[model samples]
Target: MSTSRFSSYQPFFFALVLAFGVFIGVMLGPIMGSKPTPTQARSTYTRMDSILAYIDNRYVDSINTDSLLDVMITNYLNDPATIDSFFKFLDPHSNYIHKEDLQGFNEDLEGNFDGIGIEFNILNDTILVVTALSGGPSEKLGIQSGDQIIRIDDTLVAGIGVTNQQVMSMLRGKKGTVVEVDIKRRGENELIPFRITRDVIPVHSVDVAYMIDDITGYIKVNKFSANTPYEFADAVIKLNSRGMKQLILDLRSNPGGYLQGAVSLADQFIPGKELIVYTEGRAVGRTEERSGKAGLFEQGKLIVLVNEGSASASEILAGALQDNHRATIVGRRSFGKGLVQEVYPLPDTSAVRLTIARYYTPSGKSIQRSYANGTDAYYDEYMQIVMNGDADSVNGRKA
Candidate 1:
């Protein structure tokens, strides 16, 4: 059935169970290609099948399916927590986002989330500022890139196991709101205080771009968000004006996002009409994205930096560049995530991301690594790579 047609049954019980099955069992690396319609038949009738048939056949219309889900789960699984725990076994990426976290998740994907505007990392148990975003509230307050955030308001967040989410919660807020942060700067004895008035921070994919030395330019992309390609192009234009002859596109530690963003980024490097990536599945036929017009950095010498953290869209961009021989891929093996996800919002404001298609590189190799053992084993494979000293070993799989 079509996804739209299937989702239309949202008010019913079968849709919910099907969604659960999709969330946990679907594998990445194969797109659902278009197929001829099959004849509908009621073939098998088993125990679980009988339960599903009963819900579809006997459930009253006035009964709320949402509430029914809760009741059924409470009876079968004892609680919704069990369902959440079990669904994770399906895939490493496929999971449900509760209604409370959906807004934050969407904000990240949309490429604009309100904050003081600083990209940070926990280095040595300290919130080290990777970069104070250009034209952001923190940048306006003279917060430099190397500054460390030791405290938010009165809380000493440093060296206290404060997580990224915790810091984000403290920093992010509505526009016109003020946040106070204590900074630790090099060659400074006392902590520097800054009262930053929060605003709509443009969460850029191209985090920072600067001319290295005389002719080499560097651009670090944090994620492949909605506006990544445009942002990257704008950065390239600025560097081009500054006599940039070579480019280093950094995708290190960038967990990928939108697929279109990766294709657009690859388009900027590869010249002429060239195939970038393709998707094929049982339900979704062969769909290929090719480079169109001349790209912004087509003439420049390019280098793409990827590591174990580079994944999904990151792998797509790297794979495209690698297959076309457009740029030298330097660093470790990318996080293999060849599957595509389509987020569907539920009636209760919660959302579930279903793995829809497996993507392939220009050379027609699957980007996803093996997940046959389970989600934990799939993730552990990377750790095994690290332990086996194979991080620098280029396995030449194309994908």
Candidate 2:
């Protein structure tokens, strides 16, 4: 009877010990050699990752993640409160370029785009064709300058406060695609209709190059694009053949483009290994650009034309020439933009043009205007200058 009772208590004791051992293993699993499960490891995710995951898994409604990310990035970049503390001030030029606008933005600097190829401007609620680009479909179809576009396809576009973007969307399409437009010519009572097939159109940086006088040549540069150097070289060659001993490079109302384009243009005017421009930044450090190779117009009497509208690469060219004493700076004071921007492409094919450095002329003068008061105030100052007719003055004298 004693042995049977002992055996029953022994089974109970053994069962109790097994249960205790199991509990100890469970408690020490994390602290010991046991690896974390997938769910446990997920808890170590970053705050942004956690938020995104929660939105993806627990949100009430479904959403397009791509579009959501785009909006979020755009909003964050535009919001002043979300700016990083390291940046003391906000730069208006440092901007986010949407994926949709990326192609057009690149094409502008690339000096080519697929379109019917007509330069236009909206004036008095009418889309006026400034000029049908040379060798373009519109030019081939007798679409001349000063012609008004009253209709695009079946849509009446004239006198409707139509924007330049709207007109471009209506006209521009893929190569070999046809776009229809109705024109209202200057002396015609009837509207002329034309179907133009779009193609790769060359964007000319040098607007016009002609002999102004017996010894003076005038070249109006609209922008400094990839094709600028070539266009400028061609213009110089033509002008030189026409007995041009002096040159008037018109940079009036010219908004700048690529930095390399400006440096190339400056090299044409300034001979020897003279410092054209130098850029300095906290991250990028000092980068000096000097004139290289024999230039086309190095021996000519050069005159650079600038105004309040001239900025960036335009300012760079003008500043280099003025500082080197290679050219006389005419017109009003230039639009003081000396900031250098570098484009960084994102994974989504969008891009950011960030102000990476501040450029200076050879004399080491920074022409960038103060923007400590904010972008609105900065632009307002320029508007004030315009209103006061200071933009029209040149060298302390009225034009």
Candidate 3:
């Protein structure tokens, strides 16, 4: 299931998906707490009995209903073009990212990929930069944080229906490739054209790590991604080398990644037997992850920072640390996405990342946000609030 070359980086993009809100579907449904033992397997035999018996004993047609259903399902997902077309007819938020589209989608999730490395928000037909990586082509070419991206190559980037994917498709390519982009800065009306060479950029998981002061080392981690635990270990070692006796871990914007990755990272700071988080759903019974082995930094004064974006794996780490009193958590309430999503690869190279169940912090607080009004409305309610208050985020969420 770990799709990358490096085992350490296996959890890389999994956590970032939760932030894009697309993972509401990707990280989408029910947990079976109990695994199917031999007896359970025997119990499952009856599930297919009626259908198999019908195929063998009754039915008017060829009686290949089960096989026919399997073929239909396979063919449906194998056709990416048809799926994309189908998505075009659906709500804008309901998107279908093909295997090819997956790369670009992942790029958006991690904040970096093979490209110019700039985050842009479409505004009034103008592609405006939300932020630019300092070493990226956009930054190298003097593209400021708020610069307007007017055109990519010869294509004008502004206008209705311009998607985030289109911008990347135009700008991203194999290394050494060059793409022409025109910019309209806020201070000037003149359009400035710059040629940007595409390159492989490393997406960072450690958002902020610095000395809180002389003795306290503070590191804000967005998620437990591929190489996260190892990275945390290395960071800890480096800080220890620098004579840090206390640590502050910040998981403010994290949306969660691999459950194992969170576990691995949490293991570095927790010791003895302790419940991090537990899951239960319609199909599954109860599953709990207990701390194993002593953490490497168990002797330090530790604190964790959290906020609304924190969920899932983030909650696991926070909950585990808090449950055991391994660290102190300070911040606003987390997003409460305590459900788990398991990724299953289909025959077509496509996948179904389905939510398994409701995960709980040790104190039994459900980290899953209220999504009862259907997924679409549930997802867009935030934007609706912002719009209603004329771009006031706090006011809208407060409303």
- List the RMSD of every prediction in angstroms: 12.6, 18.1, 14.7
After superposition, the stretches of candidate 2 with alpha carbons farther than 4 Å from their true spots are: 1-89, 116-167, 174-200, 379-399
lDDT for every model?
0.74, 0.75, 0.63
For the record, the alpha-carbon RMSD of candidate 1 to the native fold, in angstroms, is 12.6
lDDT (10s digit) by residue, model 1, range 1-399: 235533544455576577555422321113212221222113433344334434444567544444555566568763445656655545666777766657767776675777888766665578877567667888888997567789899999999998656777899889999889999988899999999999988766777899996999999997888988788999999999999999999998677889999999898889999999998755777789999978888987889999887888999999999999999999988788898888998777888887767889999999888766777787666656533443321111000
Indicate which candidate wins on lDDT. 2
lDDT at position 255, candidate 1: 76
Backbone Cα, N, C clashes tallied per candidate: 16, 0, 16
Order of all candidates by lDDT, from best down to worst? Answer: 2, 1, 3
State the lDDT of candidate 3 residue by residue for 157-255, as single tens digits: 677567656666777788888888888765686888888888876555675567877899988675566767767877888788888999988887566
TM-scores vs. true structure, each candidate = 0.65, 0.64, 0.66
When sorted by TM-score, best at the front, the candidate numbers are 3, 1, 2
Q: Is candidate 1 or candidate 2 better by lDDT?
A: 2
Alpha carbon deviation, residue 229, candidate 2 (Å)? 1.5
